[model samples]
Target chain A: MNIDLFFIPLQIQDELSLQNKTVIVVDVLRASTTIATALKNGARAIIPVASIENAVKYASTLEPGSFLLCGERGGKIIDGFDLGNSPFEYTEEKVMGKTLIYASTNGSVAITKTKYAKHSLVAGFINISEVVKFVSENSDDILILCSGKLNRFCIEDTVCGGMIAFLLTKGKSRKRLNLSDSTVSAIKLYKFYSKNLLKMLRESEHGRFLIELGFEEDLKVASSIDSIPILPIFSDGVIKALK
Target chain B: MNIDLFFIPLQIQDELSLQNKTVIVVDVLRASTTIATALKNGARAIIPVASIENAVKYASTLEPGSFLLCGERGGKIIDGFDLGNSPFEYTEEKVMGKTLIYASTNGSVAITKTKYAKHSLVAGFINISEVVKFVSENSDDILILCSGKLNRFCIEDTVCGGMIAFLLTKGKSRKRLNLSDSTVSAIKLYKFYSKNLLKMLRESEHGRFLIELGFEEDLKVASSIDSIPILPIFSDGVIKALK
Candidate 1:
């Protein structure tokens, strides 16, 4: 197995290069967590748009009451949107059976860029095991793409990526598995911070920014491993829980 | 002091943003090591060009015997160039008092991009202490730019970067120093690998490639700490050892 990791979407020079790879997009705090929560709570499907204008445009095509305008900009709910990026905003009662037009500042942009990937899945600590299980059983070439904040590296996402890479390669022979430098570094980082993920998140740049924005509880939710154990796959412009 | 690190040049969206910041460009495997060696051996100045065409174009303006075209493509010397990117090729007998129009695949491109930086210095493990001493005594806001191989992360450069960041913050309080996620991660990676840099380089993807291409000796030179002991600063389109 060949496992490669990209710290941010900027590392991807050509989106078409991902055509044959199983791509796992990670946005630990909190797009991946929020998406998995929404899906587990029974959101119909998530249409990830790169911009607010696109989200609104996609919303106009759906039945007025069937879909909710969901997403965040700078860790806050977009003005007049139904929900922000926090997993707490995605309650069972609020998201059940609703289609979401999501437009986050980073995660959605990264997810949309993987439209050409063979299998694109959204992952976080909440659904790491599921994503790993899916990739381990079905993938030979994998790309762990971290949706870094605005094309810059963020610790929480990278640590989450490291955790996923560590899980995927655990017990595998070093000779058979081809790991990129980023993958090797990610695994090392995962081992260093795995003992206390919440603390690592709290000390991260984006984590501190979110905390200042009154989203400290969101960090706790994002740090819980395998809490929402569903594989959210993005294909054909929509993200849905894979059965 | 605020310290930031970039794993690759792609993260830098605006060159102007680097203004007023002391930028340390690291390409540990060869460029940084070779440039330091050439300068320490009595080269007049090193002019880094982004492409072979630029190197050739710049050569046309220099007196024929005064300059040499240097650099590599795919870990081998470029066709008909004066030298490959190995410290061994840059002996005092060959390079003394001559200007080198250098154009390696990754490092030169990264060096040229730092034209707007307040002070841009090339670094490898070979001249680490000298570069660190210069930056520590002269700058407040710093950016350690790892000239990652082709805008993708390379272990050697990043570990070297982590080492620099680690040294810069050695005695400082965490409360007073601002570190970016990349900076923190680089420091952790440096700590994990500092004990045996040569072994780490031998295992890195690029390092293995250079080994395969018969440049194993270059890795040994690059992995050596402060062997060259010179600060090669880039300014006014030339790199010269600071007197």
Candidate 2:
């Protein structure tokens, strides 16, 4: 198996390269963690829009009561939207049986860019094993795409990507995969920060910004490894729980 | 002091942001290491041209016997150029008192991009302390620009940048500097790889490639931390040893 990691989606020169490959999109701070939580709470489907304008336009096409216009701009719930990006806002009572129209600063853009991928799965610290198992079982080439904050590198997303890479390569199948330089670097980073992930998140730039906005609890929710086991896969232009 | 780290020069959106700031350009695999070696061997100066066209045009204005046209493409010396990017070739006898018209795949382009910087210093594992001391004494915001191979992140350059950040912040001045997420990330990576610089260089992608070309000795030369105490600063379109 050939495995490569991109620090940010901007590094991708041609989206066509993702075609027929398993592309795992990671956004550890909130977008990915919230999406997984929303899916676990029974979200029917998620329509990820790349921009706020697109999110608003896409929501208009749906029957008003059937879907929720959900997203955040600068970590705050957009005015007139139904939800912010915090995982705490995605409780079972709120997201159950709802169609979430999602847009975020980084994660949504990365997800929509993967429309042509064979398998684009959402991942974070919340559902590590499920993603690892999904990729291990599939024989396709893999691309771990970290949805870094606004086309910049994020330590949290990278560490999470590295953790996945490390786990996948640690098994007996490790000898079969060819790891890229970025992939090796990610694995090294994961090893360095695995001791206390919550502290890492709380001290990160994005994490500190979220904390100043009074979302400290969200960091705790996002750092619980393997807490949510559902695999949220994007295919056919929509994200659905991989049942 | 405010410090930020860009894993690759591509992260820099506007070059003007580097103006009036101290920018440390790092290309550990060869360009930086080779340049340091040439300067240490008593080269009069290094004129870093961003492109092959620029290098040829600039060399035309110089006296024929005064300078050497140098650079590499695909790890081999460019056609009609005097030298490839190997540290060994830049010995005392060959380069002493001769100006080097330098260009390379990544490092030269990155160096030219810092034309507006207040102080643009080249760095590698070979001269970490001198670069650190320069930054520590200066009050300007620092930007460590890693000249990753072809705009893709190279582990070695980043690790070297991290070591600088680690040392700069590890001192009592740590509390005064506000590090961006990427800066903090680089510092952590530096700490992890600091234990075995030679092993890290030998295992990197560029390192392995150089070994295939029989430039294995170059990797050893690049990994010797503080081996070359000189600091090469780029200014006014020419690179010279900072007396």
lDDT (10s digit) by residue, model 1, range B201-242: 999999999999998988999999988999999998999999
Alpha carbon RMSD to native, model 1:
1.0
Expressed as tens digits, the lDDT of each residue in B1-243 for candidate 2 is: 888888777787788978879999999988889999999999999999888999999999989988999999889999999888998899899899999999899999999989999999999999989999989998999999999888678889989999998888775566687999888888877888889988988888888888998889999899998999989999999999889
- Residue B78 of model 2 has an lDDT of 90
Best by TM-score: 1
> lDDT by residue for model 2 over A127-183, one digit each (tens)?
999999999998899999999998888889999999999998886565777888889
lDDT of 1 by residue, A69-124 (tens): 99998888999899989888889899999999999999999999999999999999
TM-score of each: 0.98, 0.94
Q: What DockQ values do the models have?
A: 0.90, 0.66
lDDT of 2 at B61: 97
